[model samples]
Target: MDIFKELQERGLIYQHTNEEALRKRLDSGPMTLYCGFDPTADSLHIGSLLPILVLKRFQLAGHIPIALVGGGTGLIGDPSGKAAERILNPQEVVEQWASKIKDQLGHFLDFETKESPAIIANNYDWLGSLQVIEFLRDIGKNFPLGAMLAKDAVEARMSKGISYTEFSYMILQSYDYLKLNEVYGCEMQVGGSDQWGNITAGIDLIRRTSGDQVKEMYGLTMPLVTKSDGVKFGKTESGTVWLNAEKTSPYKFYQFWMNTDDQDVIRFLKYFTFLSLDEIAVLAEGVEKEPEKRKAQRTLAVEVTKLVHGQEALERAEKISSALFGGGLTNLTSAELEEGFSDVPSATIESPEIGLVDLLIKGEVVTSKRLAREAIENGAIYINDIRYTDVETSVSQLERLDGKYLVIRRGKKNYYLIKFK
Candidate 1:
């Protein structure tokens, strides 16, 4: 099977310009393909994973890839997936976010590959300086009003309201295709399924502007990632699962995949991992026969976490996971402790010599001194997973985890953290 066929089998191709033509084109030689990433946020989330992986897949298949960071269009906002018009970000702020996003895209594609080193292009180079009159004459004239209004992205919001700034997004995105094609010989555009309208708009722009000078260009999108339960993928109770470690720690990132529903694990493996079809088929069988083993989920979590966070981070994440659920935080470093218990409630202690009951009261482990004493005597209070019954025992005597953090367990599952300065 060809590369496009491989994408189809893996369920990555949602829409393509033309299957036979794109396949013949792929088989012909190494062609340049591009995917746009708008820097609406400092870091890309798991929502952007499918297309980034697709770009890597094509690069592995011997095609040149262009990871376009939308420094320009990001300022304008693509109305494709928004329910309402977006608040325009300041230029400097958007530029900062664009640079960060460019760095994040580097984690996926190898820019140093000798065969066809990936290219990172920002649309701002051209869009930022284009005068209004020149833009209207050169780029905006190609887009007919009726066609622009007809797009599902625009039409969906017609009843509620749409802004002129957002309505012109498709044209600006179309110009991105024209600009890339004119400069880098990019023949294909890829994005999410929501971008069908935008991608096709770009394609049409190329067809009109190039006037048979450019060869046939194509567009493809990936399906929107979703869970069987109907909740969106890449989300937890905490918030979005970001690609940045500081935003979403490797431990939480690993846990997100580890908690994948049994029904979704195999599909996610196909979409996210570079594992061979035969290997994935075997894992699928394991999912069928040994649902309780959670073998598939574990593999998915490990593979994805390793891909996104690298080896050392993945190891730390696993160590954190083991320490967390295994009822011990004693072995964790200060950094690991901070990452694992980032969401847990925490209090600070000025001195390490505070009384145990007073520490409990200060940490809010119990409502009051009486409650703290009752819990301590009842053997329900645990300090660093060790039963601490002596209310008079100084906290300084207990060995602190990483010489600073105290793990307080009120009951079996309720956990709190105390930090010594």
Candidate 2:
């Protein structure tokens, strides 16, 4: 099947320009396509995953893929989706973020392959060198004020009073496309639905600047992902789901997918995983026939975790999950415990041994020794997954996991980590 049809089937295509020409271009032969990622943060979040996957999809289809890092344009943030002007980062900080994002982009694409290896380009390479006069005379002449004002990005921000710096962002992005087309023979640009205006602007800029020399250029955008309940995707009460392991541990990342709402799991599998349509359809049948088993959610979590964090990390995440839910913590490693309990309540104590009641009070797992004793009597207190019904029970180094920590559970879900210093 053609890439376009495949994307349509997977619900990736939101909007596109010149569909016939793009279809003909893809059918004729392999072509180069580019997607830009602005370095607004050091790590890309779940929101950025779709575009990166699109670039990978093109590369896997025997087409050249160019991943552009917006080191230059990030200085003047794109006002596509924001209601307020962005607080610009210092040049050094922007450079650091750009470098990190470039490295992260590499994980998704194969750069060493002999055929159509992925290319990474930074817009700063050429953008930082353009003179003010040259920019105004050569690039700025193509964008008229009325047309710029009419763009959805600018129009949305007009009521909020956008600054000229942000108003000029589309031109810079358009210039990026022109440069990529000239240098890398990139004929298509793909992004989220919010970037439809900017993507089309680039196509127009290339046509106007290069005149008859420029071949047909295309713009494609994927739908902005949202939850079935109408809330935004890729967010929890804590914050965004980051790609960096440090920012969001592989354990939490795996759980995020594992807890996917039954209404959204099948849709997300198509968008995020490279599984075949028939395979996904089978999972969909399981979702209906055996919703209680959560087969689809588990598969989604495993596939996505393995893709982002690799097999080793996925195994560790699974081990952590199983140990926590199935009472199998006897063999957890220190690193696994750290990742698993990274967000759990924790306390540090100098002594390696303490009475059960004292430990509960000191670790703030209970309000007072009286309450702790009551909980123990009621069989609600557990240490290292072992029920301790005696209030006088001592928790010593013998009960510590990895010889340095104790896992305390109050009732079924509340977990506390006690560190022995």
Candidate 3:
């Protein structure tokens, strides 16, 4: 199947300008396709995954992918999907975050080789240099104010008073397409479904500016991913699930996928993974036969985690997940154990010299040494999975896992993390 057909089947193609013609153009040669990442935050969330995956698909199909960092447009803020005016970060902060984002993209896209080596560009390179008069006359003239005002993002915020700067975002984005077309012959742009208006605007800009002197530019967009229950995708109880491991650890990232609802699993498999139709069909069968096993969910989580976090990180995340949820902690790596125990409630002591009863009292695992002794005597307190019967046993008797982390269980289901300095 052709690229467009495959995207449609995978639910990746939301809307494209002249889908047939664009597919024809893509088939003709190794075209340079582009996707813009607006550095709205320090790290990308799950919402941004669609475009990155699309770029990967284009690369796999022998097309060159140009990843655009929206250092300029991010300053102005695109109003495409916002309910209110975004608080613009100071330019310096945005620049810093943009650089960090560029670094983080390495985990997903390869930029080393010349043959389809992923190319990166910052829109600030061109946008920051343009003069106001030049912009108004040359670029602004093509966009009619009426058409701009009719957009959903603008119209929704119009009642709340959209700012002039926010209103002009489409124009700036259109200019990005024009510049890319002129400089690198970048003919295609990919974005989320909310960006349909902006993508078409860019396509029109390329047509108007180049005056049919070059090949027609293309726009491909993926649908905004939404959960079946109406909550937004990529969000957790805490907030956004970030791509940066520091912001959202690899284990949590994997759990985000592992917890996918049965209904959404198949669709997620298609949109996120490069797994072919036949392979997905097999997974679908497994989902039918044994929903309790959650085999498809595991496969989806594994594939996505590997893609985003690499094999080593994926393995660590899996180990952490199994150890925590499966209630078995002995096989966990030191890093995995640390990650699993990081958020649990715990207290620390300088040394293992204290007696078990006094340590439990001091560590606040029990209110008093008497209570701590009773719990241990009744087989309630576990030190490294062993029930300590002797209250006089020193804290040194506790077996430290990996020579650092100590898992303290208070009765069942109440766990505490302890680390020795």
Best candidate according to TM-score:
2
* lDDT (Cα, tens digit) per residue for candidate 3, span 56-90: 88887778888899999989998888888889899
Separate clash counts for every candidate: 0, 0, 0
Give the per-residue lDDT digits (tens) of candidate 1, residues 155-260: 9989989889888889989998989998999999998999999999999888888775756999999998989998888888899999999999999999999999
Ranking by TM-score: 2, 1, 3
Task: Name the runs in model 2 displaced over 4 angstroms.
Answer: none
User: What tens digits encode model 2's per-residue C-alpha lDDT throughout 52-164?
Assistant: 99889888888899999999998989999999999999999999999999999999999999999999999999989989998999999999889899999999999999999
- Give the Cα lDDT of each candidate: 0.91, 0.91, 0.84
Residue pairs in collision within model 1? none
User: lDDT (0-100) at residue 259 of candidate 1?
Assistant: 94
Model 2 residue pairs with clashes = none
Residue pairs with colliding backbones in model 3 are none
Q: Candidate 1, which ten residues in sequence have the lowest lDDT sum?
A: 206-215
How far off is residue 88 in model 1, in Å? 1.2
Q: After superposition, how far is residue 73 of candidate 3 from its true place, in Å?
A: 1.4
